[model samples]
Target chain A: MSNTQGNLNTTAEVGIVEDGGSFPPFDSTTYPSQLLWLVLSFGVFYWVMSKVVLPRIGGILEDRRDRIAGDMAEASRLKQETDEAIASYESALAEARKKATTMAHDARSKVKAETESARAAAEEQLAAKLSESEQSISKITAESLSHVGEIAAETTGELVKALIGGRAPAKAEVAKAVDAALK
Target chain B: MAGNSGNAIDPIHQFHISKIFPVEIGGVDFSFTNASLFMVVTVAVATLFLVLSTNRRGLVPSRAQLMAEMSYEFVAATLRGSAGNDGMRFFPLVFSLFMFVFVANMLGMFPYFFTVTSQIIVTFALAILVIGTVTIYGFFKHGAGFLKLFVPSGVPAGVIPLVSAIEVISFLSRPVSLSVRLFANMLAGHITLKVFAGFVVMLTGFGAVGVASAVLPLILTVAITALEFLVAFLQAYVFTVLTCMYLADALHPSH
Candidate 1:
């Protein structure tokens, strides 16, 4: 390879006699080609980057950003909905608690009122029975006293008949005697 | 042939251009050469890497896609940082320049491969392209107001001419510095690596002691090669960064 390179350099030296063994970079003969190719190649590169490569990457990045934003929005919306649901559920629980308390209070008061009325009715019936019994006892006592008086009068008349033979007392006199004894 | 020759440790020999297919057009030698071949290879490799990586366009990006995206965002961020969002208009140009230079530099790191960016004309051409874009776009966008780039806003009236002159000179030197920085770095790094490698080769010509002593230069060569790799990436970055700054000047010329 070195020998070939040597040969090539000899040939290049012979072909380009004007180069005069100057530094390759400073050699102006190669500038036109280098510049030409640079322009052409760089031009093509610029075109590809601008027209094809950049847009594709840009589009991908934009799409990813949009998707992330959309996902975040959805998550936030769902969270809001969940918060609303929780709020409504709490309110409903509070309402139910209030209603149950009211119902229990009403039932307690109604039971108390029914018990009071029943107790009052029973007391009134007992009082009426006591008064009726008192009235019957008083009547029976009066009747028994009248019978005792009659018996007393009969006994007095028998004794008189026995003592004074054949002397009968008058009915009016007997009634008067009996009435005085009773008095 | 130069490698076989005992004392022929000519580092410049690697840079020599040879015609692969000689052709004449209008009496000018437009022959395809090794430099041209490498340029085409750089373009092909860069294109393939970019295109194939994004072929799937997966929302969940693959590794190659991630790499492609990183490169895009990296360049994009640099431009946006210096030139603002408006500089994105020149994204294609900037991206192309970066990829071409970076890939060309990386490919040249291979043994026996031709380095396209080592040529001054090529780097000069790219620098001119950047400066040309800046000048043309500056004038087109800002008209004569673009000249305000030379006139800083808060300068005293006394030194306005001096400041403007300095600004003009600096602006003019942008291309020269841009091109030379990259070209010199590559040239010097390669030459240094070649010279150190030549030391290792030359030392091995001695007996057992020479082979043992070659270890030092060999180690240095390895270290220099690593440094060259870093420089390869760095030069590309520096070139693109300057390009972005210049474009920024074009975008907003008033200091």
Candidate 2:
């Protein structure tokens, strides 16, 4: 449609020459193309960014992520180890406490058992002493009684004999008296 | 063959870059020309786009803001996907470059518009700048350590020098290679379009039979024009991406 309008101007009539001059010299006849320069400049800058700057920045970011991940993992591992250590410590402490209480209970029971055995031994010693004292008392009492009997009998006989000498007729009376006393 | 139009100026002469500066210094020809003017215009337009897009302050961007956002996003995404998050920072440069070249290319599709990029000097200059920046950046960041980039880690020491020398040569050749790729593609596409267009005009200008024959050329022109549009955009995109890759090399100094 635009071509039908005959918009091909003076420049359009000219054809591209392969062997065109080395470069355009500054002149009205040969003007620089704005679009070309724009494209060229853009191309250059883009090339620099894509080629040089972008990759390094990427590397740095990648490095940062890696570092952060590594640090976090290390910290987590360390924390886990610490938690295990604490749990083990508490368990050990609880075990020790349990053992201590068991030991205390056993000691108290031993003390109570020793006290009961000591009390039984003391009771047996007391019973033996009481029996021996009773035996001695009985023996002493028997000896005293026998001595008194002997003394009394001898005195009576002597009296009787004196009375009989004074009077031969009294012999029957003395024998009767002895018999009554015996009865 | 349509009889030669006796008054027709040599069509090829139109492409000449007539000297504006009749002077030379140290064997270097520095001259202002149409190609230079277009370069200035491209830069000005690019700057204008950036300034206009960002000038207004808004929590929610308006149409212009959206346009600006999309442009940056498109370029940034492409760079990031190709390069990485690190490339995101270089969004402005890549985006601008793509826009400038793309706009220039589209503009040239217009009948009268000049294609400055069609010139080797313009393309070469741009390529040189990229290469130079990459080299400079590598040395600045890595110091002498940048040399190690060519030494591929894990390689045997016996072959180190040989490998490094090869790497250096290839690296040094980047600018020329880059310049030629863009220049060659643009030059070829434009020339083909022009020749086809010429055929359409000349053939149809003859009798009815000529016009019927001209239909084939016209159809071809239409197809070429559409294809050219794609080519224009593609070339720009390819050029920009390649530049980014080269810069990546410099930043990391990879062998």
Candidate 3:
């Protein structure tokens, strides 16, 4: 490979050269055989690359693409389901809340209605008891006033009998006089 | 070899074409040369790299598998971007071309190894195949309208013929430029390195002065060698992208 072999390389120039003719690169003798080899080698590599290597890489890429698409689709579906679930859950909670509010309102109204009716009934019972007691008290007061009048007239007769000795007024006459006085 | 005879260090001599095994049929030489051996080696290495790296074909890639997938995606993306999804049909061709050229150029970087891409005939053959495929695809797909590729739509009536002629000439010169670009780059870089290496060898004489003088060429040789490796990969990329553009033209004849 050393270029000191003067007899071997005569066209080697010191600086950059242009197109070559006398150099081996310009040789036309080996064109056909080299071409034949090129064709064979190129054919083999082409078959391997197109049929084997490229297809494998393409398959990998396609697989990754499919996998990503599948994942995205799955994620979106799960999101939709989750959203639906949330919506249903919220609706159920709202329904429960509405039902509980109605029940509480009904219980409050029931308790209020019961309290009002009970107070009205207790007040009626108290008014009836008061009227009965007031009638009994008036009757007792009338009977006691008659007793006092009788006692006053009887005591007056006894006083007259003691004072006038044997000259006491008749019982009937005395009652008539007492009655007039009471009127 | 670098003595007074001055016959040992000839940079161009390394590219000499010689038959490793001599064969002749119909007065035509079909003999295998060092170039053929390296071509096989190129094929072997390229094929082996892909086949072994992909033998497992696991989801989590090893380094080799990553390398394999990277090259595959690199060419695939280039073709797809340049020619659209339909260009995927030509993925195998583009991938093979990239790998072959890249491996051949890299192999040439080693000592005592032949660079197949440095040859005009080899690069010319590949270029012709690409151009031929593009032309055939254009005609097959678009029929007679494929010729419209040579005529721009907005040219004035007076300048149409002149513009058409220039465009047609440019279009036809694609293969020449394509092949020459890679061949010339490889040829110039390798020849420069050989020349500089020869200078280093030649300067070993004259005692201290020779030693001091050899240092410059040695540094330059190192720098140029590094630059050449970069050029090797760059040329391969340029060739592949250009091929994709041509393929694009084939698919979309208007562009």
Candidate 4:
């Protein structure tokens, strides 16, 4: 291992110092080319990044942000419209319910008034007919009593004539006698 | 051991610089090397991932788009948290640094790939850029008052100079620490992984007992590789966070 180490050291020294007369990294001969290339490549890279790539990416990000904001605004606006529609519909429903209740109340009151008036008219007509019927009944009763007195006077006259051979009482006196008995 | 003196067991060989296309501009060698290729590849991959994933711009993001957006938001939040809203002016630079370092580290995790952040020069250059921006912008924004960052308030008059001197020294050490932190982490992690792997190879060459014992280093190598992945991400985050804090000082230099 030591022998290998020694060999490795010698090989490294010869390769680094003798072949290039200096370490490759510290070699002055390669500086110009390295610098030249570094400047050129790095310059190009910077130019491309600043001028082209960065702006496009930034623009994409910005555009996405704006679109999201705009979409959110549109969504909220639609929600607001929907909310307003619901509120209006609810109010309209409440108004219609109120109107229906008022109409029902008015119809009930009108029906009740009409029914009361009809009942009163019917009772008044019944009362008038009943009074007329009572008057007729009393008149009929008086007429019937007069007839009965006449009948009775006839019967009596007949009987007396039979008994006494042809004597008949006057009708007026008979009717007066029946009236006093009826009273 | 005697036969194995090649670059295979040499851990440092992986960091070697070999030119693919040798270019000389006014007698200076600015050749495109493996390091350069990886840097370009890193940028390409990061750019492609970001661009292609976000091409659709789906409001509900796809997996790829989510990953990309998360990365962006993560860095953005970090920057905003550390430096406040005013510190967002440095977002591009901070994001670029983070992506570059992160992708570079991840790409280097593959076998036979160059780790760009492991290069001191590269990390140093990045650190210098950060510190440079902080210094320049601080001065430009606050004029001479930017120097007040070193002279914190509430110190007694006698202790003010001592406090300021210490503060100045600490402020200057920011770049050194920042650069070395990333570079050293990458360098040490890779070296350790390579050495363990080399140990596996060396042990395996010693017959049946060697092969049986090589499992320890092999397992350790695997674990270290996993740990390296974490370090890659952590280093990137650390670098960007520090960058934000430094930029905060630039924007408000009082304390």
Candidate 5:
């Protein structure tokens, strides 16, 4: 604690130069030797930073950009494929729909035509049958009248001849009676 | 102190740091010193450390590999915390500065070695380098609009000039503050340690009571030494963190 003379002298020696040297304000005069070296150091540091270190960082960033771009492109490509597939499916569906509708329409029209023609043919057959029935009825009526007429004529002729024979037994009455019977 | 008296205390100083070539434009006294040598040494050491740490190509992580990873993670964590993930880009500069300062500080603890960071010139150079880097990076990243750092956002237009002036003053003070912080901490701690050790030696030479009194300073000195060690690490951390913050500001000047 009381070793003042020695410690004080030693500590005092440190500032002796401080006061004598104007406290050295750290200007160019104080470090005149270091200027060139400082410039050189800075130059080297700047070069390395610009050339090696920064480039590596920039490269990493570029790689990330490339990766992102690639992924986006792949996604877009897949999306395009999906769109094309959907379009193809829709077109095929539309074509099938049109074909089915046409087929249905054609079938319906054919059925209608067939139905109309069949109805017309049936009407013609009915007309033919009606005409044939009318002809058969006429023939049957004609045959029945002729038979009645024949029977009446024969009975009348017979009655007349018997009267004439009974009444006048003459040769002239007998001859007329025989002629009537023969006619 | 007596063992190495015949040899000069510093050998690495022989390597030229900067040699002033004569310039007689306006009677300016320009000369170079050993400070440049240490700057070069710092760079070389930093380069060696980095290259060697990453030299071994092993996934299992050898000692150097582990050290390199730790160095990277240390700076990366600091940057991420201060400047968000954006700071990771500047990890090399921050990590190199931290290692350089840490190694320089530890080197001073060795006998007969110079403390580069203790010199105002060295610390100033480092601080100025950081400021210059951040300034350049900010402007480059944001172009001319980086001047917005001074005006900031959501400030009133009436006080724009005044606030901008103040902001400019503060911005200009960055290098001084950063350098002074490191220089003062190192200079003060070292001097205090030297002074206390002198007291211990001087008092121990006295009688029993003198020796007993030495214990107090000894304990205080030990505590201060431990604190000084923490400060050494802390100062380096603070410097790197501030550097990252400055870099972040430069990267996104609006922040």
Candidate 6:
């Protein structure tokens, strides 16, 4: 609406001249008319937006925001629970490992003690058997010494008989000699 | 009837207000003018656009619903950013202002369509509404303390009177500036476009050489058309931003 519309149009088929003068928008006469309609038009549009369209769109956005926030909160809670579960699981596994280690140590010690006691009992039985065998060997040797003295006295008596007629006196002396030899 | 080849090139002719029906009340001319027709048309089309687009209220949103949502968010964000969440109480008015002006400006770009916002009287009324609400609401909310808006902080006592006077003058001019900014932008862009189109029409009248030369204005007209579209959205944004700032000032009355 400039003031420079002086050269706009002087001839027209509609033959109207209201808009020909320096832009009719600047014309004070038309202000009331324009204002009346602008108010009516703006009022209706505002009513639609405030009372209808805006709220609808606003409601959808608000719903979407709330849903997303709820989902995120749930996800975080689940994650925290999962983390706790993992921690408890790990601790349980460590407890099992400690139990296994103590059980293995007890079993190893028990096996060693049993083997040591068995070995000690076997050694005591072997020592007693060895002493009995030594006693048998000494008894045989004493018996053989007594047998040698007796056999020598008999042989001396035989030799005296064959030598001449006085065998009885030689036998007594040979017996004494054989006995001393045995001693 | 006015679109005859002879008068088709008349740029100012499109702006004429013909009486579709004479409406006079008392001695005043309350006639329904051509401007009123387009104003009604603008509102109907904007309403239909929002209604049809958001009929479904789809969470996923159809194209029309998306557009409707965008328009809502555009003004919503502006209000929240400039005026804070409290300022959202005035969402209806600000959204109406932006959509009405934007649609009006866009409608005027078509042939034979009247640009409602091109009229200063119309834009001024809107500005007055905004500033008027701010003033009334500020006074009601803050009582006499709202007057402190004019007083600059950290000023010398001697210059306090002068600074406050200047501030008051600036505040008073708010409506004028607000209205004029939209009016001038729409008015100037339309005029430039008309001038270029008129050049094409005038040039083509001189035979082959004239028709060939008309291409220059044709190209410029096309270019300006693109620019005007951007201006349409920009002007509406600027208006809403200013309105939000004024409303914020009222709510808080902070300098």
Candidate lDDT scores, in order, read 0.88, 0.63, 0.81, 0.88, 0.66, 0.84
How many pairs of residues collide in model 1? 1
Clash counts for the predictions, in order: 1, 27, 15, 0, 2, 0
Query: Per-residue lDDT for A1-183 in model 6, tens only?
Result: 222122223322333543345556777767777777778878888888889888878898898788889999999999999999999999999999999999999999999999999988998888888888888877888898778777878876666666765546565688998788767
Ranking by DockQ: 6, 1, 4, 3, 5, 2
- Please give the C-alpha DockQ score of model 5: 0.07
Docking class of 5: incorrect
Task: Count clashing pairs, candidate 5.
Answer: 2
What would the per-residue lDDT of candidate 4 be over residues B76-115, giving only the tens digit for each residue?
9999999999998888889889999999999989987879
lDDT of 5 by residue, B66-108 (tens): 6755665677788888888877777667766787787666655
Candidate 3, residues A66-156, lDDT tens digits: the string is 8789999999999999999999999999999999999999999999999999999999999999999999999999999879867867877
Question: Which ranges of candidate 5 are over 4 A from the true structure?
Answer: A1-30, A34-183, B1-50
Native contact fraction per model: 0.51, 0.13, 0.52, 0.69, 0.17, 0.66
Model 4 ranges with Cα > 4 A deviation: A1-21, A97-183, B1-5
- For candidate 5, write residues A123-176 as lDDT tens digits: 999999998998998988899866754555555555665767654344555455
Candidate 3, residue B141: CA error in Å? Answer: 1.9
Residue lDDT tens for model 3, B50-117: 87887776666789988887887898888998999999888888888899899999998996677889
By summed lDDT, the worst window of 10 consecutive residues in model 2 chain A runs over A4-13
lDDT of 4 by residue, A51-162 (tens): 9887877787788889999999999999999999999999999999999999999999999999999999999999999989998999999999768877877776677667
Q: Under CAPRI classification, how is model 4 graded? A: acceptable
Off by over 4 Å in 3: A1-21, A67-183, B1-14, B194-226
- When only chain A is evaluated, what TM-score does every model earn? 0.56, 0.52, 0.57, 0.53, 0.59, 0.58
Q: Which 10 consecutive residues of model 2 chain B have the lowest summed lDDT?
A: B1-10
- DockQ of all predictions against the true structure, Cα-based: 0.33, 0.06, 0.28, 0.30, 0.07, 0.40
Best by DockQ: 6
Q: What are the runs in model 6 whose C-alpha is more than 4 Å off?
A: A1-15, A18-20, A84-109, A127-183, B1-6
